[model samples]
Target: MSKKFTIPSHSEIQNAKSNRNNPTPAIFQKRKQSEQPNESIIEENVPKQSSEKVMNKTSTFRSFQSDSKPTVPTVTPVSANSSQSPEKAVDKSGTYRSFETVNRPQKPLVSTTTPLLVNSKQRGNPILKHIHNVAWEYSDIVPDYILGQTTCALFLSLRYHQLHPGYIHERLKLLGRTFELRVLLAQVDIKDSSHICQQLANICLLADCTLILAFTPEEAGRYLELYKAFENKPPDLIMEKSEESFEAKLIDTLTSVKKINKTDAITLYSTFGSVKNIFTATEEDLSLCSGIGPLKAKRLHKAFNEPFIKNIKKKAIEEVNSTEVKEKCEKGIGNENDNENEGC
Candidate 1:
């Protein structure tokens, strides 16, 4: 008593298809393929290697449908056996592309042999450029390491608002520690720089700077003489004393040797210390000290060498008389002078 479903005949199905465009399985598949064309379009637009070959193919198979100038179009994919030729499709898709916009980088104008500053464009600090150049120029005289240390010390002092004293002292101390005596001594000879000498002298007094003193035997000997002279004299010589000072002795020495007046001589001595030091000092350096002029310096130089010069008039009085005879003669002369004064 079960009823069975009957299958429709082919004529009935054909009549229904003619009546409506209903999408069966095959039509539905075609519709789906048409909806998604992005991948196919991208693949079709990909250019073949050579544009010339594609252009030739386009000309051969293509017909001018319009009398107007034909513009080349981008290519789309076509089946090999389809009515669309590969050349026409490749040309139409613009896949025979030879056009490219590449960026070409510029070359630097550096040569292998160019100098450091010029080639590297390392202008350095404008203010320090001269100093840097000078350092390199005399690298043989002053090593890079020492120059760097000195410059750094100077910069630090400036930044800290320090005077030249601490900077100079520390640097000289470092030099001593490093045992750069020869260089230090050479620097002591700098006529244009007495700060270096003054610092060295202070170091010697402090007993902290030993390298320079040890390196040069001659300078050491001179320094020894100076020390001995200091020790034998009163502290007043170097310090303030009511009776006498180092300044006074120095003035006396200069006055004795130079035959200058007490005031001018004291001024010169106070300014330059000793006869020898004054004589040896350059005019410019002496002028900076105080109360020194070209004339004074010249006169001092002459006075310093006077001891060796012949003074005939003063030599006769220096002859030694026998002690007994000299006393009797002095007595006789005094009595005669007294009688003559009494008569007047």
Candidate 2:
């Protein structure tokens, strides 16, 4: 069988071809002359009157701005040689003022004189002078507060002793007395109680008085008991001396001669059997003792080796002999001068 085909009309064929070649308005314009040439045509067609109006508006705005705007005052730089304080610097024209100079006041100069620390009365007191010297010597070990408390305690204790002649013996009699004094003072709320106790202990030690083993409150009651037990006992006689242990005597001797602390004394005694052994011990041996470094050992050795009493006696005898010989020589020279005068 033969099939018949439907033919497109001329108009339909032309429309379809046009749509395929230029589907959108942009593509159709692109096929013509460039779009830049059209832009010039548009700008030429625009009215000159609109441009003139815009220029006139801009000119009016500029004039309004010039009239309404504020004027800024000119600022001159300040000079180094200006006749004004550093706080009050003057500008080159001398018109502008500094806020600091106007608002702030000048500070006064400070005094240079050193204020006196000790009063005249303290200086006069030998005890106070001694304490001050001790505090200075041991400044590294003792603090200012401790030193102050010690001074106050010593003053009060000495004052009390003076007021009560027989009550406070010439020497501190018992170690328990330190605790008793502390307990008596505790109710008064003394400042730095521990330091005060330590100072009192040191004073008692210097006076050759017995001292408490510890400064704790717990030991205070024990001290009271000891005081009661020893209260009835008669005072120790000078002639009838109590037998002190060898170690105690050794420690006392070491402390007195070497000026060492109790710990160092004990260490020395422990290392060497007796005081004689300690004195005889070389610096190396002394250094081997615990807590005694080479420096302290050298000092200990020097103190022991020093001929203190022997040197003093020898010096005294030499001085006397020299004086006698000088007197005899002077007499002899006077006799010779007389003989010469007689001959003349």
Candidate 3:
């Protein structure tokens, strides 16, 4: 069947066009209120669907998180009666360990052999080896007594080139019986060769030791001749008793009396010519001598000029007694002569 087409009237179309173009105020207000209600409905419906989608997404996230979590390992406590050591268990665990289970260094084992046994063959002599070892291993190889003796001898030798026998004997007494003469002499430092010869001569005179000098055959005969001449030489008694000359004797006398040395004595003797002259000379005269200072001159002058009171008193008494005795003898002789004449 063919549907009949209907067309709007002209008046109705014109009225619809007028309503769209210019609507009343009340109609516009009604349309806006209607649009507001529809928009509120759309907003409410959109929020409900969005909230449901968010809830579904959160549930899916929670399931994924549960599946991805790692499992915690379980640990079984080791029994005390276990065959393995605690260190072995700790090593197997490979995570945590105690300080007691850590590896420690071990000490090496040492043999019980003596040092002498080990080194004697290489050193050739056990005694020498022991001495070397002791000397090398220790700082104090010298004994306290030896050091003390050396120190004392050094001080004494520095002061006096020749040590007295009495003083040495006293020191020996203090050192007891174990003191060594060689060691003491080795420690003494005599600076001069002449002093050493003098010391050797003095030692020969004082001690019982004999010194021998060995020489090559080429020089032996010459030395032998010298030795013979020395042996045949006369004793030095005269030289010891008297000096080489009167000046030397005068120097020695001045040294003895005035406590001056040979140099000063020589200077004084050369200036004064004689001991009597030196005694009579004034302090000014002594000071004028070479090498004689004012203090030494004054000392010499005072010693020589001071009179001997005891001797003077003794001489005066003897003279007085002699005069009185002579007078008495003369008077007795006169009386005796007179008596003898009367008797005649």
Candidate 4:
């Protein structure tokens, strides 16, 4: 078996050799270049030298950051000697009761040694006695209505009529008719006090008898002291014949006159020392007494100045002497007639 072989044309064989030796046309070559990467293309795909250098520095920083980071220190746990169960904690059941504090009853702080208020019978202070005595003259003499009118007048007059202690005592002594004074006081009590002065005027009654009395501050004090001593004690005018008796009499006289609606009378009694003194008192002097109004004082002055018994006595004495002389002359004539008849 002999095989027949077809031979390639010389042009064809030369074209094959030329195609292998020479590059293709520009268009075909460009297509082939595009399809495959050259050295420049490969370099463009890779970073430039500066960028590669920066990448190297970033890698160094990452490594340094990883190495420089701080680490937490590890702590080892301690072991117990034995794993014994914990002992049960004991709790106390004892009660802590607060003590009951009782408050004691407080006692009143009174002193046992203090003295009682029992009155003593000793002499009282003399100055107090004097002041009380003086105040009584104002009270006994001055009425509430006329106090303002006669204040200065009474004050000056009373001040002027300053009695010595001895004189005060003597004046009180003379007015010490205690029984008669008490009777007068009791009668005045029975009478209607409002009509006492009026009734006396209507009846034309004279004061049955005049009580001579005097007032002074010392007398008031003495009476106060007497009352203090004898008050609540038994009455015995004779047995209690002390200074108190005299003081009682003085009080009686004063109280009687006061009760008779005659404060003016009492005031006059105080100033003049007796009814006689008031009877003789001038209008000006009586006017100075407290409660004596101008008209009443003037009336009293006129009444006193007009002598009652004094004038009557003078006239009676003159009549009696004249009658005695006339009787003697008639007796002598009758004697001559009897002689002539006997001779005939």
* Most TM-score-accurate candidate: 2
CA lDDT, every model vs. true structure: 0.45, 0.52, 0.50, 0.43
Compute the lDDT of residue 208 as modeled in candidate 4: 31
Q: What is the C-alpha RMSD of each candidate to the true structure, in Å?
A: 27.1, 33.6, 36.8, 43.8
- Candidates 2 and 3 compared: the better one by TM-score is 2
Per-candidate TM-scores read 0.19, 0.26, 0.23, 0.19
Write model 2 residue lDDT over 1-344, tens digit each, in one string. 89998999999999999989977787767777563445456446544455446447555322321336555555444555766654454454556566455459767697432221233332343333323212122222211111221121112232343445444333234223332232221111243456655655666556544344333333433433343334335567325674488877777777875548889998888778777798899999998877888988888998989877768878999899778667666666557775455342
**Candidate 3 collision pairs:** none
What TM-score would you give candidate 4 relative to the actual structure?
0.19
By TM-score, the candidates rank as 2, 3, 4, 1
What C-alpha lDDT does candidate 4 achieve relative to the native structure?
A: 0.43
C-alpha positional error of residue 283 in candidate 3 after TM-score superposition, expressed in Å:
2.0
Model 3 agreement with the true structure over 245-341: per-residue lDDT tens digits: 8777777677865657889988887777777888999888998988888988888887777675747877999899778667666666557775465
Candidate 1 vs candidate 4: the TM-score winner is 4
Show the lowest summed lDDT stretch of 10 residues, model 4: 145-154
Residues forming the 10-long window of minimal summed lDDT in candidate 1: 148-157
Off by over 4 Å in 1: 1-128, 131-164, 180-344
